[model samples]
Every structure is written in structure tokens, then in C-alpha cells.
Target: MVIEWLTLMVPADWHERFIAADTAIWTHFLAQQPGYVGKQIWRNPAKPDELTLLIHWQSRQQWKAIAPTALAAVEQEFRQNLGRSFDIIAANEYQPLADGSISSQRPMAD
Candidate 1:
């Protein structure tokens, strides 16, 4: 499987809103793609503003196949809705040592 790994820095005061926007981009945009498996959001206590996202896909090629235009739209929506760009620390892809299955999906925020 392929994973999209991203580290972001968002203000503590914007935590819930940031999560909502981020989750919307993932669930509403990425999840609509052909091979999306799941996504996970992680928070760092040491640096409250630090957040990490892992987006799983069936394969690297499938994930890369996502149309650039669609991605741009989602990013545009994120910025327009959230009012700021997340300070991205790291963004990359990875292959797990062993391809595993996720039994359950993340609960979407209302």
C-alpha cells in the first residue's frame, strides 16, 4: 500500500476548525478517488500545533493517478474555508513494510 504522510502546524486555537477542514478535504475529496483506503490524523502533545496525516491507498500509481485539477480544487476549498494555509512541515509518500488492512474507518466530524 501507499501512504501520504504530511506534517502540519496549525494554531492551537484553530484545532477543531482545522480538523474539520482537513477531514473534509480527505473525506470529501481524496476518498472519492479510485484507490483511497483510509486516513488517520495524529496530534503532537509536545508541540500542540503539530499534526500529522496518513492517507492510505491501494498503490502508489493509483494514488498518483488523482487528477491535479481535482486536488487543486480541494486545496482551494480548504484555504477558502479555513482562511489560512497550514504550515506544512513534511509531505511525502511511503510504502509499508507489510501491506495491512484497516478494520474500521475514522469517524467523520459533524
Candidate 2:
């Protein structure tokens, strides 16, 4: 699996609005795309303005296969829905190591 990590800055007061619009726009659009597995949104109490998004994909190729034009359109829709632009603090991609830690039978939590 490939994981897309994005850290964004959205004012605390706009957290709810951001989540609502993101779920309605980006999440929905991603779900319809090939290789999309799932996504999660997270926040830290100490960093109320920061939002972290974890997007899972079946493979790096599949994730990168999304056309630039399609991505631009979705981003435009997202901005329009939120009525503002968000700052992306960081973005990164990760893939599971060859070691079987992730895929092993051992549970991550008891």
C-alpha cells in the first residue's frame, strides 16, 4: 500500500467548515478514482490550525496515475466550496517496508 500524507493549515474557527467541504469534495472525488483505498483526517490539540490527511492507495503508480487536469478541477471545486484556499504545510508519500511488520499476522493493538 502507498500512503499520501498531507499537512494543511486551516484556521481553528474554520475546522468544521474545512472538514465538511473536504469530505464532500476531495474525499468523494478520491473514492471514485482507481486505487483509492481510504482516507483519514486528523488534528492535534496543540496545533489547532493544522490538519493532517492520510490517503491510502493500492500502489504508488495508481496514485500518481490521476491526471493533472482532473486533479486541478477537483482542487478548484474544493476551493470554491470552501470559499478560501488552504496552505499545505507539508506533503509526502510512503510505502510499506519489505519487512513483514505491517502485513504480518501480529495485531498492531491488543
Candidate 3:
């Protein structure tokens, strides 16, 4: 399994808007993608402006296939259409270890 971790630093005032945008995309993925297993969205406990997205896929290829189109929509539609909402800081990706762990040996909590 592969996990795509997207850590975004968003503007504080636009949190709701960001969530709305993400929710839309999440719904889209759930409906159209068979390879998408699940996803989790997180926010920094300390920093209100930080958000983290964990997307699980069946394989890297499945993820890569949908990534470009989804990302382009997020960039062109969400970002451009709603620049007043927030500023995206960064995004990253990772593969699970043999033990099904990415950052730690322990399993991620539900």
C-alpha cells in the first residue's frame, strides 16, 4: 500500500474553505476511484494554520494516475478560483514500510 501525505500550511482565516474544497475532492475520489482505499484529514493541534492529508491507495501507479488530474483541479480550480481562502505551503508522499508503517512502527490510529 502507498500513502500520499500532503502537509499544507494554510491561512488561519480560510480553514473552513479549505475543508470545503477538500471535502468536495474527497467525495469525487470516493465516487470515481476504485483504487482509493481511504483518506484522513488532520490539523495541527498547536498550529491552527497547518493541515495534513493522508491518502491511501492500492498502489503507486493508481495514485500517480489520478494525482495529476486531481492536483490540477485543485490548483486551477480550487487555488485559482479561491485564492482568498488560503495559501498552500507544501506537499509530500511516502510508501508504507513492511510493517505498514510510514513514520513510526506503530499503526496509525483510527
Top candidate (TM-score): 2
TM-score of 2: 0.88
Ranking by lDDT: 2, 1, 3
Q: What is the lDDT of residue 96 in candidate 3?
A: 68
Against the true structure, whose lDDT is highest? Answer: 2
User: What lDDT score goes with residue 63 in model 2?
Assistant: 96
- Tell me the number of clashing residue pairs for each predicted model: 0, 0, 0
Give per-residue lDDT, candidate 3, residue 84.
48
Query: Higher-lDDT candidate among 1 and 3?
Result: 1
Candidate 1: RMSD to truth: 8.3
Give a tens-digit lDDT track for model 3, residues 3-55: 87877878667777778876775546454776788888788979887888888
- TM-score for candidate 1, please give it: 0.84
Compared with the true structure, all predictions reach lDDT values of: 0.86, 0.93, 0.72
Score every model by TM-score: 0.84, 0.88, 0.69
List the candidate 2 regions with Cα displacement exceeding 4 Å: 98-110
> How well is each residue in 21-87 modelled by candidate 2, as lDDT tens digits?
9999999999999999999999988999999999999999999999999999999999998888999
Model 2 deviation from native, Cα RMSD in Å: 3.8
Better candidate by TM-score, 1 or 3: 1
